[model samples]
Target: MKTANKPRTSGSGTKRNGAAANGKKMPDVNGPAGDGKRPSLYANVIKQFDKAADMMRLDGNIRKILASTMNEIIVNFPVKMDDGRIEIFRGYRVQHNDVLGPFKGGLRYHPAVNIDEVRALATWMTWKSAIAEIPYGGAKGGIQIDPSRQKYSINELERITRRFTFALGNNIGPEYDIPAPDVNTNPQIMAWIMDTYLQMMPPHERQRCIHVVTGKPIKSGGSLGRDKATGQGVVYLIERWAEEQGFDLDGSTYIVQGFGNVGSWAARLMKPHGAKMVAVEDVAGALYNPEGIDPDDLIAYAKEHSDIFGYPDAKPIDHMAFMGTKADIFIPAALESQITALTAPMLKVRLVAEGANGPTDPDGDRILLERGIHLIPDILCNSGGVIVSYFEWLQNKRSEFWDLDEVDAKLKKKIVSAYERVQGVAHHYKTDWRNAAYIVALTRLENVYKERGIFP
Candidate 1:
């Protein structure tokens, strides 16, 4: 696959004193460049790879190959709108690696989706799966259309998905690139992709193609406990951490940012564990009550009202205040960059469990570290989704479905075991969890790469 040239600013805008620009100095992955200030996603991914490579003393050739995506497909397809107009949408699917198995990751639907962002996400998936000891690689796809805008009808979305899937062709398969649900995408969307793939396959091929996609509804061969898998996994990690620290969750408090699938389910699971759901926030707004809000009641209310703002049981709070609220645990399940340096120090919590990818900026992470708050990094905390997605893929390939209880048990074991491994590394290295996790994952990837060696 041909790699796109890295974007460069010409003339005096370039920095001369920085590390060599000829791939000698690894790019700054965390530097701000977006909006001309935050670093681009591609730069961030490269920066991370460079850091891990340096620490592991990786070979130059392997570093370059691992740093660059193996495949990136950009699609500019036209979809007919409800008003009889053809709207051209930009979509991207990036496969970072397939060394372990077929690439696996989520397909997000949002206006902010970009090639750089998808590439970064796919790269992260590679590390995440490796860290979790899963037999998968990394790939990510996204349509740059905002689902909130009713510009496209359901039929149009289906058409777009089918076209994108078909465009992928042999690039994706039951043992190739498997796309699951991500931000703004759900089981229904996965079902659409599966149906579309089946429609294009022969009868015998269809049977083998069911594993091509995961996160489908259970009735459609999806895993039974997949819906709440990520959230449950987060709760499991929190419980393990609490036990390690001797913190009882019975009367503990939590502030959750994001009321979507992960956040909502996390609140519900933690509630039954005796944790008080004091604050829940989403794009609509935030709701808070020091005495504790019932997750069951809040979920029902949000279902009916579409937002947590008008819930009579809790007082409405500003989004900023929600972050600074006092709680035992604070979960950023909304989106990346929600927790920053400004918000990190203000958090009156003992732990920050990331439910979203890259939720904390580098600066914010430093602040949280200075304050002695334990951070259960995104790679370890939010791995449940992918873990169950792996299970779903396995069942699809074997044509054997497990019960909900079985799935849940397996997920909890995997997540808790991964958490303990991360914690052990943190203690052994005497470093924060994030660095410890990066070390652990980097070590695993490096070892595997060495074992496999180079293919001449």
Candidate 2:
């Protein structure tokens, strides 16, 4: 548990902390550029939207509408700390667009989390839901405090979460902005949100409002396979891509950046296909093993040491070396803007399946395109988490639970169909996959407005 009030980020904006084997500084992949100005994630998202809109020659009015956020909710509430100190915490909920359906996204807990990042994520959620053919728009919110470095205990965190939920009040609901787990947040935190929201409602409403938030524990109305859905989705896409490109996963090597829930599950799920994860990198440091490290071993090490920076079983390597490793695939399951213009050229992978939202910046995407790297857009690649989240919401609303296999099977079908649709759209437009994905989403929204027309 983290101490409360004093906030810090989880290795975000981290500089070149590791030196290369030749003793030169490793370029900071996810931090401020040479001018010390951090790249704007929201701006990057807009750039993608603009490019797609241009390709489609979309109407100016619709383009402007899709390019902007629909609603922005910011709140500041005081939480009584364990030491009886009242510490004010800032929170934000950005509902990008709900034209398709109710707003849906995640609630992240990180000190580095801000309105812009949340807005970008919310916007991406809109595209993701559309690409996956899910009836959801987009919204993302989070409290601005690092879960790891915070001074709050479990009880204090619960109080703060409930108070935050209380502050949002009617802004969230079963058919409205549904929040799920994001970085530094998990099922337990979601359970707290669910319980708090339920307590505030009337008896009949309380029983029906559990869908106010998805990603809760199973007992709390969460779906069976929601935990591994995102990672499983990544592997499913990789399998289909491998088949399309005639690339064999057997005896093939890949590199995973970030060994959290997404990266770890990706490795474990891919091992059965004989795919080898040769390198792993996280905030602690990077690890390399050409012989292939066991996914279970790595998971156990991370559990025991709280990280995988210096696991004795693998050779520790630098950031540049990890990026430059010989691999068939590179999964950036870490943070936004991790692969910048500088580090983009160092990639040796044939495919980049974005496991994290906005992992590749606009500049990086341009470089990858010029280099002919098969870049799977984050919106489509990471739609599984939200898709499974939709399943959880559906289960709660219908008062029916799905089995693990049923959830996984449904997620795979939805994501694979999305991948095929994106490929066909890209081919038809003569554009890249990222732009194609945006077009798919924008076109859907455009049709909605065209038929319904803007209200007074």
Question: All models: lDDT?
Answer: 0.82, 0.85
Q: What TM-score should be assigned to candidate 2?
A: 0.87
List of clashing residue pairs for candidate 1: 29-44, 32-37, 32-38, 32-39, 33-37, 33-38, 33-39, 34-38
Model 2 C-alpha lDDT per residue in residues 59-175, reported as the tens digit of each score:
888887888888777776667767666666668788888889999998987766776677788888898898898999998999877555345688888888999999888888889
Candidate 1: list runs displaced more than 4 Å: 1-38, 76-90, 146-149
Q: What is the TM-score of each candidate against the true structure?
A: 0.87, 0.87
Clashes of each: 8, 7
Q: Note each model's CA RMSD in angstroms.
A: 8.1, 8.8
Return the number of clashes found in candidate 2.
7
Residues 1-456, candidate 1: write the lDDT tens digits.
223533222234434331232212222243433657766777877886676567556777667777878888776555555555555555678889888778998899876777778888888999899878888999998887766534556877787787777766666778888999888888888998888788888988888888889999888989988888889999999989999899999999999999988999999999888899899898889998999999889899989988787899999989788888999999889888887878887899999999987899888988999998989999999999899999999898888989988998899888888888888878887777887777677677667778898787
Lowest summed lDDT across 10 adjacent residues in model 1 is found at 18-27
